[model samples]
Target: MIELQGVHKAFGPKRVLNGIDLTVPTGESMVIIGGSGTGKSVLIKCILGLIRHDAGQILLDGEDVTKAERDAFLARFGMLFQGGALFDSLTVWQNVAFRLLRGSLKRPKDEAREIAIEKLRRVGLKPDVADLFPAELSGGMQKRVGLARAIAAEPEIIFFDEPTTGLDPIMSGVINDLIREIVVEMGATAMTITHDMTSVRAIADKVAMLHDGVIQWTGPVSQLDESGDPYLDQFIHGRAEGPIEAVR
Candidate 1:
């Protein structure tokens, strides 16, 4: 459960998020769509407190968590980064179980390894792959490992950052299906940010389009095609000639 009200942020003279207001229900899957440099990622950072908002209210589960004890609050979340961002030194299992193996939450090594392998299987990875390092796997395999890592702690909320990016069409489809399954099977509240249309169709129950630093459209995924916002139309159809301005 998350809510943002009139959130505003800027970098020097360039305003990023003008006034972002959005919400995600306790167990809902909400995906945000937008072109690059539209402040989609910045919105996410604000929600997570990775970036400070100038003045606004961000409520997590009806509580004001914007300035709360951050780590205690953030422990409730898991995130799959766009680049996979795995450590080169740690094996796949360690990467998945990183938080579990260190600090006060540390579990027995054997127990952590077992949970890591189980999560890997849930993401359609073979058991033996757990022993390999990130560089040893292909890009698709790396993404699967990243998903496994994201869900390893079984956090109540999961944020997926471009889960289907940089892969071939088939691999992207595979990752999309895995994300959908995780959201449904775990009943985890999901917030995904991506530009991939296929990822939108597969992983989103509700869609919100971010443009010019605000949510221009938010609707059920089924109605996305017929929303009639020229910007949304241009984005989902991948058209070069519509209401969206080209980078020329």
Candidate 2:
């Protein structure tokens, strides 16, 4: 459903993505693992056209993403940001129904609220929580709210950025399981960028390791342990030694 070929991106003297090539088949989950500053977020931005690549091609279902109409293109995607990124001023249902309340996906306010409540339930939150502000919710609740919002629009593609960041192990596991289940049930193509190996193990059908601005290794999750690539080895095992140099 998505493909990148020889993609390149840089800011002044620093090059973040260099010759990146990846393919995400339709209705499958692809998780990208990499060290901090390795261009994982940049790669996603390039694909979404939030950041334009310097060279090469980004294709979404065989159509060039750069040339596509912005609103129409973005409407097909849903994203759960690294930070919960909820609107502090909006009530839970308002935040979840945000996209549905405006733009091309707009629905009647009452209908949007109903969909938001349903999505919230799907993410394990109850209806009573909908009228509360984000500040009233705990971190786990906030993250669940974000997940509800991501799937509320029923997007064809979903991107998860560090889905488990800041959650306790138990909550992280819950989110991982929820993400896997939602992707499967919705039949949405997913691309996630995260440092959490536990999330990778739970949510990925395929895994790609990004290093030095390129994909160093990519294969089925079942083969992850035996991939034998030094970069993948060091990153996955959290080894301080190996090909990756730990910053002091």
Query: How do the residues 1-248 of candidate 1 rate in per-residue lDDT, one tens digit apiece?
Result: 89999999999998899999999998999999999988888888888888999878899988888657777787788989898999999999999999789865689999999999999999999899999999999999998999999999898999988888889999999999999998999999999999998899999999999998889999999999999899999999898998889787
Provide C-alpha RMSD values for all models, in order. Answer: 1.1, 0.8
Give TM-scores for every candidate, taking all chains together and pairing residue i with residue i.
0.97, 0.98
Model 1 error, position 202 (Å): 0.5
Top lDDT prediction, candidate number:
2
lDDT (CA) for every model shown?
A: 0.92, 0.96
Off by over 4 Å in 2: none
- Cα misplacement distance, residue 41 of candidate 1 (Å): 1.1
How does candidate 2 fare on TM-score? 0.98
Q: Enumerate residue pairs that collide in model 1.
A: none
